[model samples]
Target: MLSYGKADVRNASHLALSNPLSKCAESTSSDLATSKLHTIIDALAFRARSIPDQTAFVHLVDGEVIEQAITYRELWSRSQSIAAYLKAFEPNGKRAVLLLDTGIEYVSWLFGLFHAGMTIIPAFPPIGSRGLSRLALICADAQPDIIVADARFSNARERLNDLLPSAMPQPYWVETTIPTGGPDCTGVGPARDDIALLQYTSGSTSTPKGVILTHANLVSNCENASLWMGDIRGRVGCTWLPPYHDMGLMGGILQPVYDGFSTLLINPGHFIQKPFRWLSAVSRYKVTVTIAPNFALDLCTDGISDAERSTLDLRHVRAIYCGAEPVRSRTIERFTDRFAAAGLDPATIGPCYGLAEATVLVAGKPVDKPFVSFHVDREMLSRGTIQVVDENAPGACPLVSSGRPAAGVEILIVDPLELQIVPEGRIGEIWVKGDNVGTGYWRNAVASSETFGGTLPEVDGQFLRTGDLGALLEGELIVTGRLKDLIIVSGRNLYPQDIELTVEETDSRIRPNGCVAVALDDGERERIAIVAEIKRSEKLDDVAQELLRRSLTAAIVAAYGVKPEHIHLATPGTIPRTTSGKVRRRAVRDALLAGNFAQYGGRTRAPVPADRSAS
Candidate 1:
């Protein structure tokens, strides 16, 4: 049995006691309290010893008033037991796929896998044949040694077996829900450099790639987040992001543990069905910190009713981090304005930027200040220059700041082709170098080298190419758009996100957040094509279609001084989206090229005036 004395437990509970103030307080010590610790296992062990009885996690089920809580002591004991059981299968140093539903149960298994020294591959539990097919592809690529799941999902073995190729080896199955007892082996875990997680990207633009994150990467990221956000040691955090995503896993689940904060977690489904439940939980639990993507903020702004807003008291919330997608300034403004009556502070809104390659957080706004944006000349922005102008200036576009880089992180805006640093206020690819950055992609050396091997002429080592276009103003970072999704028309650069947003804003008949803009090479100049989903309503005749198309075209021309070559209006859910709700622009483009939306009354490309130009 591993030794665990009373003194160790006492010391462990005090791990995060370095900061006694709330998140808003000015904390000079911007270092992770557990920076000296090598791996997350060490931190968890310390917590078990120090604050054994402190609630570690709370799960609020849909329609259930009573929330389930798990204390540190109980969590450690169960995880150790499960780890001991897993050791029988000799899973050490092997990748183990976790296909379980979200809850305290999944949390326990996650720690158990860590304790057993297994590389974890977190995947969503497959729901249907399509989901199973995706899982099968992941299984083929990962080639995991074992599959750990709830008893209810063990039957997935048969379905996966049928879908997988005959040559691949079948993985061992282990059900974590059942009670198991075995020899104690609590102290055994991975080293600092050992792989901790295989976080799969959402693949919005291409095939999914598994990002290899080490224990040190995770610990460093959590430390950087804590330091960047001030002292949130004892703050209550709430989240409904899926456990499989990087932001959800690192920022939501693991960060709280590293800081000794109690977290209230609701299922993503519940939050989608009723966004108010997320707010309600925060009010009831007095949650001080929370995080979500841009769409979730838009959803709550539009979905929550006046009566629902009246019940919410969000004054206790010190930070509401918005990330995982392009942060829209209008969404933040609308949400803050709409919720101010419920005591929501505009300062609490944090528009941050991050990706899986860097663990989770690269930069975030300080908790003490309100979110800010810069209004720049849109034409100059298209030409890679960020010229600050008055909001009412002609052709001005508001670009939200993604804050400064976290401690121990270095960011550079470099030309994508030449790999040379861009001038200040000039948009370019964002490259990051930090200890928190992951080693590389799993088993994919080409992508690993291409993305993680970026180097500058004056830099000593490789930097992570974020593939995101942004510019540095003064000291803050302003993300513009994705490099691959940049649309150049008549010598002017335009972001598809900007065009899609304009389309969504054009007509009430168009569904919110379901539009995609792509550029097609029409022999000479690039032509802009858009595929948008219309809200399901009374059938629209030819007249309605013509009016809708004209309104959309007029909106595009008004917002972006260029006419689109084609616009297609399809039924709801016709446009494809990644699992994390990011619009798959490339996939939509492919479908458009393949005539995949013919059943949804697809429209053909209309010739644009050759003399048209982006103002």
Candidate 2:
């Protein structure tokens, strides 16, 4: 049974008399253990009754300092009050877009929507014209009934007025700070099958799609994550991930609340400005679990100085979940080697894999075990085979395992075209099925049927086509790359990430995670094209730029046996990326074909072999 402090029990009894709808008597520790808590609202109510004063979330600034905190009772109260305000707009079972910046207000509004039985459509506020246009696209797609924003963003009202069409149904705008006090509001908890969130894809590979996630899906995924990560009740978590993304919303924000733990939250901008604060917060708060993408691990390793590293103590951290993008083995090695002195355990590094369609965690390694990788022949991997080899062997490529499927989740490697399960070690499309898997895309029947209704011959259950290519070796999932992103050259399959990583490693001027490899059809055959982002330094002469181009082309040929016909080097931040940080290779390819970067004139054809080494 769950444990509660004596003082909290007393406070719950008093609070229950004031608000009878909370049903505090029915949410005892025994009931919490037996009932699944269908919706997040129920979970929050349970916690409020059991641990009224327990810290739910804490926002931190620089130097690992807390700027604000919210207790379980306070969170419940504020969310209920906000829910009452939203109900006046008749938002019951309707979609509400969130435009507020990340903070306590954002958290409160999210829960408030849940309490009011409204579907949530979380989005980032626009920064400029480009951002406003993107927001326009999302609003057009979602067609929300209401929009919730913080009044602090002075430009939000103007931006919304400009982007939203006059003829379209304008959503009712509600400011979070403005209190609309009325009679005591009663919470009508959402049913298990009700739509809880309409999470939009990050649009890295294609246009964004609204994924329909039900309350059951969210609850199931959180329960599975808790089981996989061990008992997290009352544990601490830290994150600097954006609240709009799945990794942040589900893992960083919701999971802690569902598991009855306090989270140390930091703004993503703050962490990017100073990566050391992430680790320092873990040390200061004894954060047991945190999640980040692969690039964040690299940032912590490269951005932190030895002087700062010496002051950290991360022994209390049990798991550092790495996902959202491709996990690099070298990044993990570098981080562990650099921070071993700071009490970081090698086993604490957990490589995880999931998507917005799965409500976050689909698979993750156990926190007690060290990360695992397989060294396979590079040529074999390119040919769609996983042949294990020695690390020092010629053309050896290291493939990191994304761990086994989470509890109650099943993963199948199936041929994309045939929809049949493939051999265990053969690379194929990843198919997943579990209670955590979302039902379908919002209002998109064709895509929903094609993606969420995938069937396996002679199998009884439906599976989600993950669009990712991977193989299961010894029961561990090794994600290779996206099925659509594979570059086919001379009958060999080369992953774009492999080529991009090689290009970045070949030159110090090339920005890490800023290169994209794409295949262009030359009417008869598909030719390779690479768009690499370089750090803007001194202007290079035409001759020097040509020499740099040839060097990169020759390196690609030597590494993958495929020479890129066109190589375009652009300034930093030119390559488009999703909010979660996955490179938008398709968008970059389109921009390159359209000659978008011709003004900077970084494009160059490969020089002859004789002039390749001339610098």
Candidate 3:
């Protein structure tokens, strides 16, 4: 395998800086034309007319081979066909839902709905039992007029209809297998402020909220994201992320068209089954920029074999944005160290912060420098203060900075209870005010006001109250944890992600990045309880369970001096996760409260002495 040294990292950083923000520096004439183009419909038409031959999208089959590819002209023609068919229905401000999986037709329907002046609702195809129920709930909420579904998913449709039961009127279904051989679209498109899409929340915290995204909001978000991404023109992007989610939708699908670049889309299941396919595609296709959550980075580090590493050439790759979950410094460091021999630049691992309500990009670290982090006192961090400490010091916690605010986005750290701005460098709720902020949730004015209509002590304009907890240090944003996910134990704030990371690091039998920490109440005080998923090979026995619990409790007690309530060992995939693959701690708590959990009752063993050098 090829190995890259310090020179490689420096060269990659310099290369990224050389073309900084070239996309934003368009010619004045083109900029004026772009300014006049408000909706994505306008952007698509512009791309098709100006760069008809430019490759627009490539869908990787099995995450390895390019099975579907489309150019801007072809995409426009196919979408026009769908639009003309839809126009025949006279869709007067109708809400249309997309139930097809991630592929070329998905993109066609996306633009076709916009071209037909219908508000788009992007929903993941109903897959599992939960998928059916969730999709039913989404349909019930939106009450969409038209549903664009894959003809191949007839069985799933039957299950969905059975679940929803016909008490509700059936929506007009548009099967994807049907051919629409019609003329080009002739109707004028929607205005900038008109409703364009309904981006539902991931339901990670609660029921998924239907966020109303206007065309103007999306255009603003794309422009600001370009300024954050910098030099994205001519850069090829790729992702195995699902297209319905916020990061995948904005970064993978929309951002490419907005910046006039091509992107490769991979099925997420194939990547999960074989992560090597992701990097293999990047190596084979010369992908320059890609996006994935932090777990993907860890999977590549541990799952990819040395033989696989020998096959990759990553020097052409400049940035791999890691987000959508708590960004762990250990994971980033391990991935960089593991791939340095494959010409991977350590500085190319960019830790970012974003949310769906804010349109997927709020802050991203500059790509011109090496990644940086702050080692702070963990106990003090929980108490709401930033206290830098030595890396080798006791109670030292390393936190990576998520970078400064993106262009045109204003951030304020507001104390959630008082609704007043907190002082700089203090943990508080992140309130965002920007053009990218969606108008509000659909048909839910109370939640819209509670989350989107944020008002500060002296601020005049409305701000989107992001439920994330973070702090500003040295002008960079450092996200700590979710406000709802925080577990208070005897007055100390314990972040579940921090504990979950530690639990995974404690043993090899425990699955990496598959632990959930929740607060257990003993009436008088709340103690930390862990639900850890053991590796499938490590089957659960009486002795194994006892030793695992003892080791976990010992490590945690040494680190935080708190005994665990109980450690529940789950088999692989037993723990519940959100649609976007984040752990649902609230759901775990709900299950525990409902007594829907396994119990391992044995004689309580005395805790062993903790390792002096535990993480």
Per-prediction backbone clash count = 6, 0, 1
In model 1, residue pairs whose N, Cα or C atoms come closer than 3 Å (at least 3 residues apart or on different chains), thus clashing, are 9-49, 9-50, 12-46, 12-50, 13-50, 13-51
Residue 314 lDDT (model 1): 89
Model 1 / residue 24 / CA error / Å: 15
Per-residue lDDT tens digits for candidate 2, residues 364-409, read: 8986888889999999898787889999998987889999999999
User: Model 3, range 287-387, lDDT digits (tens) per residue?
Assistant: 88899899899889989999999988998888998889888899999998898888999888888888988878898888666667999998898798777
Which prediction has more favorable lDDT, 1 or 3?
Answer: 1
Over 211-310, each residue of candidate 1 has an lDDT whose tens digit, in order, gives: 9999999889977887887765447788899898889888778887777777877888889888888887787667889988888888899889999899
Order of all candidates by lDDT, from best down to worst? 1, 2, 3
User: Model 2 segments beyond 4 Å from truth?
Assistant: 1-31, 61-66, 152-154, 536-544, 598-615
Best by lDDT: 1
Worst 10 residues of 2 by lDDT: 19-28
